[model samples]
Target: MLRAIAVAVLAIGIILVALVEAPIPAVALTAVTGVTILLLLWPRSSRDSVAPSAPEPPMADARAPIEAISDPLLIVAGSRVEQANAAARKLFGAHVVGEDVRVAIRHPAATDRLAARQATADQEPIELAGIGGRDNRWQMHVADLAGDRALVHLVDRSEGHAAERMRVDFVANASHELRTPLAAILGYVETLDDDAAAEAGTRKRFLRIIRDEAWRMQRLVEDLMSLSRIEAEKFRAPETAVDLAGLAKEVHATIRDAADPRSCDVAIAIDEGLPLVAGDRAQLSQLLHNLVGNAMKYGRPGTPVTIRASRGPGAMVRLSVEDQGDGIAPEHLPRLTERFYRVAPSRSRSLGGTGLGLAIVKHIVERHRGRLDIRSTPGEGTIVNALLPIAPLSSNRNATVTGPA
Candidate 1:
């Protein structure tokens, strides 16, 4: 640019000397034009150097993607939360969006980790309790992002933890149930063996007791095996057609003698033209037996224990067992179907209940593509209703078998 300016100046001086013979106004105009040309033709970059840098393709808001994610996620800038996803809002609160992450999260370890400049990748995940309530459990994981930003992912572990606790409880309960009968049988056997002076009647009575205890233990083992098998085949939906009305009557008749109906009246009611349900016949029969047996055993003395079968909505069969007895409390209704759960442990044991009856019934109903509903009011009666899909008359009913997946 300097060389161009010098050449232009020399040319302008020669132009003025040549134009000295010309008018002074014309010479002045010519010099002005020359300077303008030199300046306009100056060397320069193609791009507009003065314009601001192409405004950063607007930092593609990562929070948008996190909003669509199912897991709870939070984006934090320093100690404050810049954004929270829908799940995060639900787990915490909508106000958490602009709050301090440590305060919003309400966890000592997690808050400390977030506050620290450095975080350990191998640090054990901090457990968050009572996210929604005391029954819930969640795990928090924090990861560093660019520019003092961090991402926190929350995983809910409530269901898994509850299932694990239930497993542990089931094993313990089964062990205790099995041990009771075994101990009774062992004690009676030893007594009979050591006492030679035991009278004939006494010996016979002790033998009866031993037999009863052995049968009780045997029943428990059988129920446990049955429960295991049912769970193994839980995913397998039953396909064979079984008449539920007939099964209900058969169960009532089978248990009529043992029901000791002096204090309870066992009755069966059937609605005509009931559709056949697609299910495992043996399991369905057992389900009916357990329900009716429970009804008869628990119904108040002289009150009617009714077993009814009728057509349900949408091509379904409704089989119900109702007992007029001291009803169960509202709290016990939810856990009644859980394995080894009994409302009255001692009463249940004396009545030869292994506490797996309702649980078995539940599995069988599930296998049949059915729904079971239990309703009871204190001092009134309890009703158990099982709704099962009617077997399709056409083919393709057994296209695929569902089993535990």
Candidate 2:
């Protein structure tokens, strides 16, 4: 009776573990566990007792729990794979069930731990790369089971590792970006305090340099903060209906009002009767400003930087900014949206770019559940397009927003 209770307890434990970790429903797990317990602890007839020498039923029953886990798990005994769950077979291969554990997991770190005759102080979770595929990463945890058996669980950590790496790289890049302008400001201030201040012209130039550096730093900080806010709210979609045509005109007016030389070259060609898009009004305004601003900065002087808005494929509203400038090389196109990535870092800095324009635009588009595309030819020019979804229950209306003649 005690033996039956132990078997019942084991079955219940497996089900509880599966309920916690596996994707299977709790009610389903409970029902399955009850059935499994009955089958494991039920009274055996004379014929079933005679078959006890055939195989160990209790141990075989334990395989159900192992298979319930989504992570790859293995039961290694005597340095050989005694049993492997479905996930393990899918990752290492179905043939790994009877293969040597060291051969099954090719990583040196995994091999060393799996091959150890006895538990040592060096036992810890092993990070294995290139296990399932190149760029794949897994955390291998080994727990010694009874009867010389080992339970090896592999959890995929590729995404978490990638996020951590991006975080580190972003910090380093931001520090360098901020440091450069700060160093410039400090050097200019020191020069102004010394012999350079004796000359009025030189002092003015030095002060101008300091002011520009300070403004650059200010812009960088603002962009960084904006990026953080956008990322924080990325998971929540904005449902506000935004009029694309009016936003385009507002951005154009703001650019023209600044009285910059490039403002004259800016052109707006928004389509008539364009529908409202589902987006945050402020973010969409910023997106337009970034795209159009990039165009004005990069496009050839006196050439048109056209901003066009019209209906797009499906339920999307297409907004594009076309610049007549030296187009980007194909190789640099893919990484353009990455923070601090620039085709010409020096030129970008000279034009007052914080290097976060496209990155912010990318995140903004992602938050709105839209698509962004950049097309360029080396000699012709580059065009950036953002397709945003039309707001539900919002239809096109007759509205006019025109740029300067």
Candidate 3:
């Protein structure tokens, strides 16, 4: 009857811990349950032979319950560490068991909070920067316990901090991008409004500039929308099979039909009998167009912009786009996929590039569970390869297949 009660109480303690932030009560309950089990399971003959003088210390009994927690937890009695869980030991060190809590943590904000003498009803969490490493962020929550003891819970906030930084940076960059073109269009329109600057030649030049800026804005908005859409469906890998050979030819023909001067220089080389890859058809089409369009914009006039598709190793299909132009510097290659990161901002703008082509391509590749590799030499030119897995036999059966041209 007592063992059953101990088990039920232990179960209740664990469930309560999950539902509340105050682990001290649960920890005490857990310690009591642990000691109860030990006393209940003692040899019946040994207990009958002699009466015990002192009960065993509960500190040893508390280790099992605390060790089950995943996050770093420390029980600080006064200024010194009473006990630490496995996670805390792993973080601060095995030697931190008896060390001062302030010395173990070693953060100004955390130290200040720990050293405070006045007792408060509620202790607010303190943010500790550079706790374990330079980029690490930790939230320190302290709960007052009996006998001046405190429960210190350290939650890693590094990933959340980084994601927030990225969101802020993205918004800033996007605003700047849109603002620049809009300013230009507004400036040109305001100048054209003046009779003095409204001569036939001047008016025509101003209107042309305005039209180009409008187109640039349009492209940026479209690319931004496309990126959002791709990110929204990133976890849902497309099960439909797409024909690489036909898609390559279609993208090439579309480019050929465009009015861009470098369109004629774009070439397509697709391997015969290439198996289909599982991917979204519309996204795949956009991916092809972005790759081919970027090559056309950056490659030198009258130079070849080759798009090749072939069966790759590991049952994957390799689609590569090569451009004959002054290649990107080695240092810039790694960050090329970051949005609004341009090697030559002025040059990119003049070429009508929205600075999102590679970023879009990257998200598209990620959504398809594919790999993107960009290889370049300063003078030799650049080539980008995307490796997409071939559709499985079962997926192929249900895939929407396109006929070859």
Candidate 4:
């Protein structure tokens, strides 16, 4: 603007001078004055003569470390979402950049916190439920990067909350199971000692009650330990070849000899030449035992408990243990693998169950990268299907190849 005005004033002065003086002298005078003015107005290249460049942002360096984290990350400058990492882009979309932090996040609590004067250390993390979709849970953690700047991290807490709930329920159920047996054992033992004149028949019955209660406690403890071991090993896949059909035969025979007369007949109809499954032998055996035993225990009196193995697509083997008995309710089927859950708690206990059978089986199947399915009809029977991946051909060479039933 200044340069344009200077040029205009020089032109006007030249015109006024030309009107009052000779054309030759007026042109010469205009040229000298314009040249002098141009020399004075020209910009210099020295630092003192030039304008300063914009300063480097202090928080620019802070983004690299936050970007390295796998969780969603957002860098906020006052009310604006100045920067966002890849995860944040995936979660909230690319429009998050340059937008207000409150609008980008859209959660009231999170926006409120971002608008806060300071992010205190003791402030609770903001929980964002059903973000992106329902059934998803996220927790937002904010850290003060600098004045009016913050680092926001989003962590998925769905699995964490579920694990916590399972843990709490497990402890509660375990306590209840043990307390019942312990109370029974203590009460019966006290009765045996106090009744000196009790008949031999009465004394024998009392002793049997004591023994049963004690054994129930022992079995519960064993199952709890087994479940702990199985869960600890769930992340580590098994490599050993386990025979589901053979294991089923062994369990069937054992149950047959010990089964009550009124109990269902145990039948093993698995394929004899099925491919071996990649799994731990002992855990697989326990898996078969639990399924077969549950069938026998829960099946209708005098009905057949059928055990069958078949080859499936994708080099997988399926082991099915079915019972023709009072089938489980539809609602109960979903939580069948939960620890210490029972369709009929009294009946389950009376039949010598620890209630951890299905839970342990579930963990064992997971460790082997296998899938377990339970299907039942109201008036019919229940069938538990265990689908395990077949062992690699090279893994079973020169080894006792077995598969899950």
Candidate 5:
């Protein structure tokens, strides 16, 4: 308001001076009037037209925060690389910043989907080959930002996918294993029932066959249940201190009593003063039993099977079952702990093996935070070693040694 009044007064003074024809005042007023007119009427300069303009909107920094994330992420702007997170840099190298989205990712499917003009705002999984010959999968989401820009987000799914595949395979394999024994039991029982009216000798043979099949089926069911329990309780270790030497002796006696005449001679060599292992006594006994039994079953007749135990590093006790049987091939050794996996399916079946023994042993050992090692050479011998962590034997719980056999 003050400025407007001053301007009005100046204009009036200029008009009066112009009318009175005072040369000095008239010239001063005229000069001031011309300056004011020029200030008001000069073409308006555009504020946005200035050089070195202001910074972009906050949306431009939308990707700045995500750059700190550890997981790979990409900011795609119309099929072009707008920005990439730190993880993406580490994954694809720093040269990917301005590179084409397709060329940078190097995955045809991912790139093609990203480049599709009609692509919907949906999330899809894309698998790609990563460094070091590893396979990587990403859950990709395409979202539209302001203007023609779009944001592509990547979430790793490789581990999740692998776990899902393993679960499916485990279910399939377990079902097949259970079905085989069930089919045998059912078939044999039906036959025995049909032949019940036959001669005494025939009836006796049928009954024996039925009994064997039933026992085999029972063993299979028992092993399956044992495996399930082991897996369920695998996260917690047993709170018992089991004597290594005593357990070995018991297992040795049991195996010897039950051994076939033609089977290998079972021997025990437990180191004196061997530390007790922390484990469930019954589970540990079962573990030892399975190992010794496996060795005897697969070992060559007239050979020797040695059960040895000694103090291992880190307060651990190592128990090993060594057999002079035809050793498993290298290809089959890795999978020996898998449920129902057999090196020689036919021969193993003939030997009355349920194939869940080693699998159960593995779960038990792992529950105690122990390691199981299988070392073998074809035609030589196979050794199964279980390294169990030992707890201090003071007021700690004592592991009961369930009788072997």
Candidate 6:
């Protein structure tokens, strides 16, 4: 196009020169027109031949349909930032473009791997700080793009890591708890078998020890089964309306009769007009039985274990088992609900505790959407409070309560 325009201007200049009668003026005008034509037709390279070539637009600009991704994408040229997608822009900010890859990402591990020229596939899991948020983990991959350009793709792995860690911890703890009972049972049985032909009294004592160990193992297995069942049925609430006061009375009566008649004293305080609770009748009975039985076994021989029940606020009933016995310290209180966690392991084992009683209690209370509180001081006593929501009374009968036993 420039060549055509220059030819037209030259032809006009020649025609104007021919029409003029003056030689010098026409000759000067012709020279000037010719120079203008030359200037217009000259190639750009002749003027600034040393100037550098302008860089090509990024390859990501004309990317394939597969490359037009919704996931975040980053284009890197060596250690420099070349381009970033909209998702990457939102994640790292718009200012990240044209900045050094290391400075833009602000993660030491990522920068170090890029600097070392190690392929990302061989690099350890690199923790990226301030990329998405503090807790987010990103696994990076480096792939070769056109020419020297490289693509860095990140995958979020925070949730996967957390789940794996939880699985590992659960397995370790469960195995440890189970091993304790198995080891004891195994050791006792081995000893009994080896010394069975000895003295009659010694053999009898060894046999008794073996029996106790077997019972302990049995209790642990049973508690595990019970926990599994409770977890499975936790979503469904009990269909029956349980009389909280009467249940408390039944538990108290059973415990009182079983108590040493001459030593331990049992007292019951079921306030009059206590409302019935919404709970499983059998589970509630077992809950009360466990709490009271724990108190009796651990309470001092002459001290009294008091069972109290009263109507609580918000259509709820509160039952408390208070025992005058050696209490738990503050540090041990938090872990009392963990399976196989005991304040005094030796004492708990001697008392034939499966170490799952408190854990079971916690699960049951949670299933009922109720609250359980344990309060204790080192030398005073411990109180276990179980609160359950009350069922509305039927129109025909008022809520009833049994008197103290």
Candidate 1, 245-339: lDDT as tens digits: 88877777777766364323788899998878888889988888888779877888888888899988887889998998999999999999999
The true-versus-predicted C-alpha distance at residue 3 of model 3, in Å, is 11
Q: Better model by TM-score, 1 or 2? A: 2
Q: Please give the distance, in angstroms, between residue 262's alpha carbon in candidate 1 and its true position after superposition.
A: 6.0
Which parts of model 6 have CA positions greater than 4 angstroms off?
1-174, 259-264, 393-405
Q: What is the TM-score of each candidate against the true structure?
A: 0.79, 0.80, 0.80, 0.70, 0.73, 0.60
Arrange candidates by TM-score, descending.
Answer: 2, 3, 1, 5, 4, 6
Q: lDDT tens digits, residues 1-405, model 4?
A: 654655665565446544643333344334334423432343221223545563324445434433433467777778899878777988999789899888888888787877773835646778997777777789887766434666677777777777777789889989999999899888988898899889999999988998999999999999999988987766567787777677777777777787467333888787768988887888988888888878877888888988889996677899888998889899999999988888888888889999899999898887777789999998899999988888984253324322221
Model 4, which residues run further than 4 Å from truth?
1-70, 80-139, 145-147, 199-201, 262-264, 393-405
| Candidate 5 local lDDT, 27-55, one digit each (tens) | 44343343233223221122234443643
lDDT of 2 by residue, 1-405 (tens): 744665565566556665553343343334334434433343343235757565433346557666755668777777889888888999989899889888899888888877673657447788999998898889887766544666677878787788888999999999999999999999888777777437888888888899999999999999999999999878667878889899999898888888788998888998999999988999999998999889999999989999999999998999999998999999999999999999999999999999999999999998888899999998889999999989983322212212111
Q: Number of backbone collisions per candidate, in order?
A: 7, 0, 0, 9, 1, 0
lDDT value, residue 12 of candidate 1? 68
Index of the highest-TM-score prediction: 2
Q: Which model is ahead, 3 or 6, in terms of lDDT?
A: 3
Q: How many pairs of residues collide in model 2?
A: 0
lDDT tens digits, residue span 262-299, model 6: 22477889899887777878788777777877787788
Instruction: For residue 144, give model 2's deviation from the true position in Å.
Output: 3.7
lDDT of each: 0.76, 0.81, 0.79, 0.75, 0.70, 0.68
> Which is superior by lDDT, 1 or 2?
2
* Error of model 1, residue 280, in angstroms: 1.0
Give all candidate RMSDs, comma-separated. 21.5, 7.5, 7.3, 20.2, 20.9, 22.3
Top candidate on lDDT is 2
